[model samples]
Target: MSGAVPLNDPRFQTDPVELYRELRRDHGAVAPILLDGDIPAWLVIGYRELHQVTGDPALYSRDSVLWNQWDNVPDDWPLLPMIGRGETSIIHTTNGQHRERAAMISDALEAVDPFTLRQHAERLADELIDSFCADGRTDIIGRYTMLLPVRVLARLLGFTDEQGPGLVTALNEMLDGGEDALTGHGHLVEAATALLTEKADGPGADVVSRMLANRGDFTVEEITKDLLMIMVAGHQPTADWIGNTLRLMLTDDRFAASLSGGRHSVGEAMTEVLWEDTPTQNVPGRWATRDTNLGNRRIRAGDLLILGVAAANFDPQIRTDSSVLTGGNTAFFSFGHGEHRCPFPAQEIAEVIARTGIEVLLDRLPDIDLAVPGEALAQRPSPWLRGLTSLPVIFSPAPALSPARRP
Candidate 1:
C-alpha cells in the first residue's frame, strides 16, 4: 500500500480532475487508494469498469458490513455517517429488500405534484433572493443555493418551516465527513424518529405519512432510518447541483449567454456540470463479496471499492473530447448506475428543484456575475462531494417582489 494514493489529499479539493487523470495514468481503471487513517481501498476511475462494478451488485455489494478494514476502523471514525454498518436503510439493503424499499421511496416521491414542487422552489428562491438582492451582492452559496433544496425538501417531507435550518446544519456537518459527522448524524436520526412519532397519529399527505402507509411491512425503526437516508441523499447533491451549475454559468464563456435571457442554455449548462463537476464525486462504496480480479488489479474478499463517479464521467476512453458540450447526454454516473442508482423519481424531484431554483434566480437577476476571480472559488474539502464553499456574486440591485408577483 506504499504507493496507494491518499483519497483525502488536499490537492483533491483544488484539481480533482487532474488528480483523477493522474490516478488513471498511474493505476489504470482501478487505483489503490487510502482513505482517512490510511485505510486501503480501490478507486474505480474507468467508465466501463465502474459500470461493470455497479451493474454486478452480487459481486460488489452495498453492505458496508462486508468491508475488510472495519476491524481497524476506530469507533469515532468520521466517515461512519457516510459508510454506516448494519444499517437497514435502502442504501445498504440489497436484492429483494432493497427493491421493496426502493419501490416505497419511489412511490412516495412520485406522489409529489411537480407543479407544487416547482412553486415551492420558486417561492423559496424568491424569498432567499429578497434577503440579499437589494444589497447587490451576496454569497449565493450560503444565502441561496445551499438553503433552497433542503428547505423545499423539508416542506415536502412534512417538516415544519422552523425545522429546515436545523436540518441544513446537521446535514452539512454529517455529509462533510469531518469530526462533527457522527454528532450531525445523531441529530438527523433524532429528528427523523421524532417526526415519524408525531406523524403516527395524524398522518398528512407528506412523504413520511405515505411511507408509513406503505405495505412493505417495514418496522418504524426501519422507516426512520430510511427517512434519514433519503434526506441525506436528496439534499446535499441537489444543493451542489445548483451551486456547481451556477458557477459554470457565471465563470465559463460558453455559458455566458445563459445570463442574458438565454433560458435554453441553462439546461445545457446543467448537463455539462453533471459530466464535469458532478456534486456526488466519489461514492464510498461497494465491497467485494469474494476474491476477484478487476481492471488488472488483484482483489480479495471484503475489499472496499470506491466508485469514482466524476472520474468515470471524465474517463478519456469514453469522453474523447471533454471540452465539447454535453447537451442532452446524460450517460454520466452523477446519479450513479444499476439497481442501486438514485431512484428515478428522486432524480426527477432533484431536477425540478435545481432547474426551478436556477431559472428563478436568473429570471430575477438577469445580470448576475461572479464577484471574485473564478480561480479564487474553493470547493469543500470532503472527498465524497464536490461543491463550492461559497459563490460570491454581484448583481444589479432590485426590489423584492411581492408574493403575488409571478416570474
Candidate 2:
C-alpha cells in the first residue's frame, strides 16, 4: 500500500483521476498513503467522508499543537509550512482561538474594498500585459498569473513593489517545500518582522496597519503571523488558480474559441479549476483528534489525513458526470469546509480575482493563443499541487502604455 499509494508515485501523479477510481474500488473512499519519509496516513477521497473530516473539529482537529506525533516529527518536515506552522493563525487554530483570529483577519482584509482591489488587480494585469505585449510572447505563469497576485497582495498589505519579489519568492519556496525550504521560511520570518516594524510607525489603511492598530489586544507577533497566513492562503494559490483557469481557456475548444462560449461562465470556469484541478490537489497533514472511523477505516489519533480535494470533487457518488462542468455545487470541497472554508467563499475571492484578471487579459490581448499544445506543458514537481510550471503564449503585438496611464 505504501509503495502504490503515495501521491508521488509516477503513475498517480501523471493521471490522478484514474488511480483515485482504482483506490476507491479497492480501499473504499478512505485510502492509506505515504508522505515524504514514508510516514503513513489516510487520504480521504470521497466527498461525504471528506466533509466528515474537514467539518468536524471535534473528531478531526486542525491545531498541530494537538498532534499526538508532534514530538516524533522532525522540525524540518517539508510539509510543515503547508499545515503545521503559524499555529496561532486562524487557519491553524481551532474553536475559540480560530473565531477570535478570524474576526481580526476579516476586519483587516475588509480594508481592501473589494471593488478597489479588483480594479488594482486589473491595472496590474494591464501593466504586465504591456511589458510583453510588444514581444508577442510571454510565459503566462511568470508574467501574468504569478506576478499579478504578488503585486496585488503586496499592495493590500501595505508593502512596496520593491518588497514584493523577495516576499513572493520566499513564500513560493515555503509552499513548494523546495530544497531551500528552511532558507525561504527564514526569509519570510525576516520580511514579516520588518513589515511589522514599518507598520509600527503608525497604522495606515492596509491590512497590516489595521492588524497593528489592535495593539490593545493583538500582539506584534500575532499580527506578523496573521500577515504570513494571508500570504500562505492567497499568494501562490491565487496565482495557480489564475494559471489553471487560463489553461482551460487556452486548451478547451469551447473556452479557447471564446472564454464565454461554454455553458460555464467565467465564474464557473474558475470554480471548475478549483474543483477539477485545484492548485493544491492534495491538502496534507490534517490530524485525527482521536481514534475515529472515517468511512470504514479506523484512523488512529494524530495520524495525518490528506483531504483529496481533487479526488473528492470527482467522487462518483456525488458527481455523476464531471466531464462537462464543476463548481457551484455545495458538494465541491475545493475551498475546504467548515471553519476552514477559504476566508471568503468561492465567488467572493478566487472567482472574482481570476475572472477579473482573465477579463483584463482578454480585452488587452484579444489575439492571444496558446504557444504550445496543452499536453506539451510541463508541471511543477511536488507530491501535492498540480500546476503548470510555465505557460507560454503568443499574441498580436501591441504598443506599450504611456507612463501617465500605467499603474
TM-score of 1: 0.98
Task: Kindly list the per-residue Cα lDDT of model 2 for residues 113-228, writing each as its tens digit.
Answer: 78887878878888888889899999999878878888888888888888888887787787776677777888987888888898888667888888777544667877778788
Which candidate leads in lDDT?
1
Task: Give the per-residue lDDT digits (tens) of candidate 1, residues 1-407.
Answer: 85799888877789888898889888899999998898899999999999999999999999998998889898899988888877778899999999998999899999999998998888898999999989999999999988999999999999997898899999999988989999999999999999999899899989999999994689999999989988988999999999999999999989888899569888998899999999999998999999999999998999999999999999999999998987679899999999999989999999999999999999889999999999999999888999999999999999999878953
- Candidate number achieving the greatest TM-score relative to the actual structure: 1
What are the clashing pairs of model 1?
A: none
lDDT for each candidate structure: 0.91, 0.76
Residue 25, model 2: lDDT of 91
